[model samples]
Target: MIDLLKAKKLIFLLVIVISSFLIITGCGRDSGADIQSAEDNSFIMNTLVQMRAHGENAEIAVEESMDRIREIEYLMSRTLEASEVSQINDNPGEFIEISEETQKVIAESLYFAELSSGKFDPSIGPIVDLWGIGTEEARVPSQAEIEEVLEFVDYNNLEIEDNRARVTKEGVKIDLGGIAKGYAADEVREIVKKHDVPSAFINIGGNVLVVGNNVDGSKWRIGIQDPRRGRGNVMAIVESKDQTIVTSGDYERYFEEDGEHYHHIFDPESGYPARTGLLSVTIITDLSLDADALSTIAYVKGLEAGMKFVEDIADVDAMFITEELDVHLSSGLTGIVEITGPDFNLIEGENFAD
Candidate 1:
């Protein structure tokens, strides 16, 4: 996630997608317009989510959107003992009744799990808790420990039917952190749509979605994070209009122990941080959920395979940042993605598979 407010001495954490704005203005926008924006941030889904809407009822829309996100967090948060996910995990083999929202997220997650050949497994909760990459207790687990957890990390074993979900294996757990934000962002879109907002940007912990254009009618500039450089240092910029930009990267949400860095994104097969040789994978598309799932799937697939995975999908494009700081784009993203960081070489037209 990016820290857009870092320069302001306040870290507005979100995934690495930077909301493009003018630095000269205090709030990072061209603010001479008669139109105004209503923005608010709340801690939900374990991230500081912020939404800015421009319209007559922008305030009401933003407030309602936050409430919607809170509801989602209550239903799906794995850490919450009373959450539906925890209820399912706490009681295996028993179908716990869930809201359609939870069912949709799980169902969508399972679809991606199958599509990525379990690379984006929803039943990877045990492995995630073991590594604790995003937690203060983050550390590398032993081979035996990881092996033991792997037995319970099968997404195929997750069953869902009639607005309920369950796991066949006792130790299996479901964590929607991988994709819940995207679903929430889409929900926010609906909230703004109902209010008929002219334009908006939803930054749910760095998974960004822009509705329409800026107040000044300029395409929103989204900055892609540079892996080598820390947050706030942009690798590239994508001029977007009404689209979702989600990136899964190894840069943040990781811990270093003994010179080995373990990231939050785990490879289900190995039960370890994904060593895909690519620093990050970004998916740009209409739906935030699709972009969210695909970004993780592509990162787990690595550079060559990741590029192919994005290319095969219609109406979707992706950018791959390599370990060598090389920026690779899918055929669809070739001309549109602008390289802003001089250190990064835009390696377009090169055969990645070879």
Candidate 2:
């Protein structure tokens, strides 16, 4: 599991102050609460600050949210020794009986695979292991080797019957690195809401889920990072209320060898880093899991087709940053999204506001 304080520190710079408002969630709350009177309580959990404010019971809410996140890590994390997911990967083809919570996440993952037409597959562990971006042994695997492993990378081979999940393939593994954080963020949001936190931001790594409207009830102005720049340099900002923002990029985790650039996002079919013209894809939605899944799906689908995918999903918006340093906003996100900074050239699509 990630050290909570250290993880929070890495992602804290991503938050930019737009406006202030109290975000409310959880069970107990006074009928009348003042924004100035609300308390901001924070704790380290699942690699980020699980924070919330309830003019009422602030401390307990923060604790509960953090606790839930820790429990989730036990279910979904690969780093944890006793994690159900880790156990499944350790002993492939063995039926791993999972908790109801684990079952639900697996179901959701399968659903996302179907929705994105396998572009957002969860059975990507073969490709992930080959690249080994998070390990010291990261390298560009040969095309022949990648293709050999691709045979075991199909989601249809993942069997979920009743409370048990079995990998039919002999060597395939499952990694939820992209979607689990968003699900955790959503869970934290629900927990705080149950405790009556008026408004808050639960950011697990770079995945952010808004607790409520800002303290003033306007919206949170989230700055989208410039992939080519250092910390705090933003290409654009979006106005959001009770929403989640998730971005997947080549630059997030990657290795360069000779003249070839290899990144974490992989194409299951090709078993190589996706050749998406976009350097990154940022997804905005009410659900963090959806945001996380789509951020990855868009990167795999490339700029043109990915934009259309966002359009197909109702109430979902996205920003695509191409290798050319151009930014493209989904039609539904155009009016509400703003571009800033000097390095990016903003282009409008004919269907930008569709």
Candidate 3:
């Protein structure tokens, strides 16, 4: 009788293991079946825009998404003479009518600006231009030069109403560089959804937005870029479906002069690159636009305050990598984030629960 009972327990354990395996391998999908995907890439928005879809209309959807991205870039680019942002910047103190799309992005930027208490200011164009971090003319601006440009960096000075935006202060410029790519990713996701693509991913300059799971119906794996390493080096990986992942790092756009590095992200108050005790901040959420702006805000807020800020928000999780190579994740991401790099250590008990 005892032998029979032991045999039954062994069989039940086997059944549980097999069931778990089936669930993890994905339900109803042939494990060996090939998942066809169509991909396209274009250099736009000052970075490479890539899209991949796994439906019958994958090619068409990718092409349409690319076109939409270009349209957004054309409309929002601050340097483009015909762009709405440029017009508003060129005509400070004068109201300029912009397209509905431009108005939407500007409105969203203003919302984030208020939410982050102006940490993610849209009116940072003048300071960005003075630093010129990403351009061939990039250089560290003098203290006086930065101060001169910083006087015009207040987001509250910009006004938006009825599809018209105007800068109340002369020399105040609006650059959508901080949040435009996320908005573009959101736009591309809409385009993909309109085409009824079942599984698609839109990557606009590393701001990734997914319409669904991977082609194989598994969770999409996204890598958090290692700030200290070159491109493609990741410190950790996160798995998700139907989420947007964005990273704001000091390493993305910067130039070194006199043994000091100056990155693109600047502190609106100090008129200099934000020294927020963070090397990079990555945000994952349902909205690409929110993730984009929040990543920058978290980085500027520093680690302790930034982690708390992200925890207070609903339906959002973040990974903050400090300059000391310590990784801090939101409570929601404690179990979901897997550290893969040896150089970084995950801070225990640092996650805040949802």
Top of the candidates by lDDT? 1
Q: Which prediction has the highest TM-score against the true structure?
A: 1
Candidate 3 lDDT at 133 equals: 73
TM-score of each: 0.92, 0.85, 0.89
Q: What are the per-residue Cα lDDT tens digits for candidate 2 across 116-198?
A: 88887788988898788755688877879888889878888777888988777678778777788888878877877787777
lDDT of 1 by residue, 264-329 (tens): 888999998999788888889999999889999999999888877777889998888888888888
Q: Regarding TM-score, does 1 or 2 come out ahead? A: 1
Task: Sort all candidates by TM-score, best to worst.
Answer: 1, 3, 2
Candidate 2: which stretches are off by over 4 Å?
Answer: 1-54, 352-354
Alpha-carbon shift of residue 286 in model 3 (angstroms): 0.3
Higher-scoring candidate on TM-score, 1 or 3: 1
Candidate 3: worst-modelled 10 consecutive residues by lDDT: 16-25
For model 2 the local lDDT of residue 72 reads 82
Better structure of 1 and 3 per lDDT = 1
Model 3 alpha-carbon drift over 4 Å, by segment:
1-36, 351-354
Candidate 1 backbone collisions, by pair: 1-14, 1-15, 1-16, 2-15, 14-205, 14-206, 15-205, 15-206
Model 3 C-alpha RMSD to native: 13.1
Model 1: residues with Cα > 4 Å off, grouped in runs: 1-32, 351-354
Residues 200-264, model 3: lDDT tens digits: 88777668887787777778777777888655567787877889889898987777787787888
